[model samples]
Target chain A: MIWRLAFATMLVLAAADKRSGYQDASPETRAMQDDDASNPGFLWVQQGETLWAERTGNAGRSCADCHASIRGVAARYPVFDARLGRPITLAQRIQQCRVERQGAGPLAPDSDALLGLTAYVGLQSRGMPIQVSIDGPARPFYEAGKALFETRQGQFNLSCAQCHDGLAGQRLAGSVIPQGHPNGYPEYRLEWQGMGSLERRIRNCMIGVRAEPFAADSPELADLELYLGWRANGLDVETPAVRP
Target chain B: MMRRRFLVLTGSGLIVPLAPMHPARATPVQVAALIAELVGDATLRDERVKLDLPVMVENGNSVGMTVSVDAALGDVRSIDVFAEGNPLPHVLRVRFGPRAGAPRIATRIRLATSQTVTAVAKLADGSCWRDRVDLLVTLAACID
Candidate 1:
């Protein structure tokens, strides 16, 4: 009972401290992230730029043909699509475009090509604040994500809020925990040694907590991502961010 | 007291030369030997190269790092990186051409434990410049 009460107090304290992951990074990491020439994440961005103009599928139309400049497009992801009657992540939207508009086959969830395009599109929104709506059609999914964030389902009996919200900045097994935000992704993680989507990072966290992670591109993960977007509303998009 | 001082001085001199024979827990001597092997017979001057890494890292699995050499070094032939504590000490080796721009490279690398990371630059002049930083890695990477 005492442990539960202490955790509750930590949660309240964490909610009051709204800090971005960037604030927790060391000076050298910050320098690598701020400079384009020194940031390796730009390598994937370059690949994405090439894929943006390549024509594919039966329609023989490239992404550029539909959206001339994708600048600021990623900032509004996890948006409510009236046609789909639900919320969808940027990855889901890309798949939708491929299958419906471009008449191309769906790229694998963790494919290099998919990551390239996602990184490319997300780069356009770099430095822009995320603005996801939780009202109107996006309401139900947003609430579900919030529930998931608060519920403790893992073997460790830890919720996302328990660590990200309550225990952020505290050392866990020798590493500092930052406020879990989804501002920068398709991020370049040093552990993965490559660019990965937000969903992939989420899966890592799930595994860390001994929880059964949702499969890539699962609606649950997308919804959880939407909640993270809302949670990190004002944080600037740092797509292709370098993370340890 | 004068005779004792002489004996102490002689004793210290002997220990200094024999220190390399018995490697300490975290000695730079091993790291230096590794760098010597990479740039055989070349004089490694401790100048110009800058290795940027965090002093304290929470997760050793994916540490962001950058290596930049002074453009004044004229022309750099190659840049090699090593993490002494990793199973494979060699991390990355990047070669540059004559027209290669600035000698700056950045990437993420894994650290098996707390150890010194070394960066060596072989210049066009056949001279080698090196820099090393001792980092405190909390949770090691590549352990799975």
Candidate 2:
């Protein structure tokens, strides 16, 4: 009888935990939903689609003038740049395009242009599963990415694992926390009036963890983005996703 | 002796400031109702619906929120989320395929004000589950 009672108690606790957003799988279901079909994100996607084709900011070069199509480009992002020999996120790719290709001034990370371009590029790989390289030169970055995932620092003193890996598929207040997947970004968070870059989202979480948010294009953030893309290796791309 | 005197002085000093206190007020129920309407027939049972929010949101603009359901895959079909105080209460509706693995999701959201958030879960066997959570927002994060 005592053993049965103890077992029941444990089950209740487990259920309670699962009901909280303490599990790694908490974000999975939300990532797949299509709630905001009429949201401004769609509008941004349309605008971004235009920007991807239009030549602007003095170089007479639109994103389309050089790159053939966004299809293969999106899926192969966060790649190791031999010049930097480090990973570069999709946002960084746009920055590279603007500075090196278009001779346009670099837009701030959260600027509408960056958000739109990221969303537009991300849409091109809509159904492709994420594929970050984890071998050869990408190995060191993968390790750095993994290490960042497990480290605990900041005011809350809680690590990413505390919520994502250690307590995945669990709840915190009353919502089910999904897995840490970048599949649904550059998402259209209702919280943000329009589309947001995946890097901005990461910065948002860092604030939640009480860590000092990195600058938009900082190497630390790039490393973290690399890890996120690799962590969600097999999930389908759902850029411009809608969230509550 | 000095430390002892300071301790005694502190003890006495602390007692003089006793004042009436009020319990933290609970969030209104309309927010919960809004969530219910958004989720449809999914019932609000504690067993299946899981809702997560910070006890105190730093700002209402982009509070992190998550919702999930616990049901036998065969018995659970879909889950929906609603933020009563958000500009759009119908946050998300997640359907599970046999291949989707588990029923779970998470995302950051905007809350227009301090309000109760709810999640409703629908089971394939014609049953429903629900849960509601109260979020205290010291600084509203969503609207800005």
The Cα local distance difference test for each model comes to: 0.76, 0.63
Write candidate 2's Cα lDDT for B1-144 as tens digits. 001111111221110111123223333465566555654665455776778887666445555667777766666677877666665667778887777667777776766667777777878766778778887754311121
Q: Each model's TM-score? A: 0.76, 0.58
Segments in model 1 whose C-alpha atoms lie over 4 Å from true places: A1-16, B1-53, B58-83, B90-110, B117-132, B140-144
Residues B26-52, candidate 1, lDDT per residue (tens digit)? 345666677888789988888889998
Model 2: per-residue Cα lDDT over A115-139, one tens digit each: 7888888888987867777678887
Error of 1 at A110 (Å): 1.9
Give candidate 2 misplaced runs (Cα > 4 Å).
A1-37, B1-144
The DockQ figures for the candidates are 0.15, 0.06
In the range A106-142, model 1's lDDT, one tens digit per residue, is 9999678888889999999999988878998798999
